[model samples]
Target: MIILKCQYLFNKILSKFFNIYTKLSFSQTGEDLIIQFIIGSLQLKKVTYLDVGTNHPFNMNNTFLMYLNGMNGVCVEPNPKLFNQIKRNRRRDKCLNVGVGINNEKTSTYYMMENSLLSTFSEEEANRMEKNGEAKILKSIPMELININDLIKFNFTTCPDVISLDAEGVDVEILNEFDFNTYRPKIFCIETISYSTNLTGVKSEEIINLMSKNGYKIFADTYVNTIFIEENLFN
Candidate 1:
């Protein structure tokens, strides 16, 4: 009777321990998994990020988990509403209410959509959405626009460790403006898909070529986002 009672007690303790462990564990997404791989491979406890097109502070955000882990950096979102939301939720991070592109324009017309994540600076994307009736315009805002490289120089004291780029349809333009030699992010989480969900409109090959020239290799591609890491870093 005593042995059976002890076994029951041990089982209860084991069950309680697992429950606690489960509560502490979080599965964010494929982005989080890739981020974890970078951190683990680099043996880094904290990292910095430049999150462009930060639609929501949490939902679909690649840097949200990093932020929770005491990592802070610039979050650029052109949408006023979403920017405000990011400001409220991410007090530790620097929030910018501006669009980033290849040229430093003083003001640019931002296409704000009902689902703010669908917002883009690309006229082609906006027109496509309108024609398909996929997304409705919430409003148009004349937002400040800066070159990606210039914005990084102005915001961060040093280059961010990781750059999470998700600029809807203009991601390539942003990359073109980025001076990879001057500011080489250890890891890049970029959305290669342009207008379609089926990867039909993705410029993945171009991005891969660009990164390959810079000595970075494709670390992982989760369909929606592709992760690249500097080849020298892993060694």
Candidate 2:
């Protein structure tokens, strides 16, 4: 009877431990969970990906998840400071220190907020903050711009299956720049933050419409990022 009681207690302990683990895993935000689910569905054992605006090479990234699953990709970051950090963490992936934009010529005066998270390519956004008494002037550096077509031709031997865009306030511009007829990525993860007192960018509905027009549908949405998949491919 003592042995059986001990076994029951052991089973209860194991059950409690599993429950805690499951709660922690599900506690991840919707975006992170969707990213994991998409990667799993893609069966990304050896596929390639492109991460635009890779800020920090943290473990929470879909790109990092790809790396963990034996996949490879490029991490493009425009911020010199952030790029260096990404390079340090993602030693195996190709890291490009250029901003992806519509034009190829270098542009200056891009404003970065004090917090860095509110950095943007839009001067209007910066000026608005200055008017509101919540901004500081930081020296802007000239950033090399590359379009999607150029990136694919220059960087990849073949086009990547997935492309994740996290450009602050410029997600739509970047999405529009891509010629979907020729280079339709199977999946996309884009950041769309609602307009707030401190933050300004494209809304979730706008991004959803743009993706829908391009034959993609919203797979999932979180506070920051939205996951889209090709309708025909996933339907």
Candidate 3:
């Protein structure tokens, strides 16, 4: 049964990539396009986003295509360079050069890594990655820390349609800080693992459980990211 399901999904994904990859591939693993396909099938329109840890405007960004598709939203990045890039490139979207979380203070140290994607605010995670030789810490810079919900409310006139989160090891922390009932993003594309792969890993179940309790269903798993859809949206 597992093999049959895998084969079915493989065929479906293959068909999707060949059909609309060019139009919908702003995300690293084509998550934007895959979500677009599902949203289209559901007859949904006017998609907006709250892109947390949006590293770049295009490279590995999950919300760039949404911006190009006439959807306006906010892009939050702790790195000043990347935030400026997003501001310059995606002029229509609100760009914030700050980290999203409930810090005790207004600012926190953001560890810049050799691989920019691995850069994070968690010192422990950074140290672990550096020890593992997975990443090298270049420097630590003070970044403004803002409450996630407050940022969303200030930027968005209405609730966001989607929320794509990729904040290194702090992804779950950011998710935990969000008021799920108030924001209630219809779709979520969240990085659930420290490593990237095509196969789902063990660490994702905790995130899945959290989202499940929030009335969301696991829609897809791209190993690095786990996509969730609000349960009520399908009704």
Instruction: Give the best candidate by TM-score.
Output: 3
Q: Per-residue alpha-carbon lDDT of model 1 for 172-234, expressed as tens digits?
A: 777877898899888998887665645476566787788788888888887777889988886
RMSD of 3: 7.6
- Residue-level lDDT tens digits of model 3 in 197-218: 3453456677788999999998
TM-score of each: 0.85, 0.78, 0.86
Error of 1 at 62 (Å): 0.3
- Full-model lDDT for every candidate: 0.78, 0.70, 0.81
Winner of 1 and 3 under lDDT: 3
Please provide, for model 2 over 103-199, each residue's C-alpha lDDT reduced to its tens digit, 9 standing for 90 to 100.
5545545566674655667777666766776665475667777787788878888778778787767778788878888887777888777445644
Candidate 3: residue pairs that collide: none
Worst 10 residues of 1 by lDDT: 20-29
Q: Evaluate residue 110 in candidate 2 and report its C-alpha lDDT on the 0 to 100 scale.
A: 54
lDDT (C-alpha) at residue 222 in model 2? 67
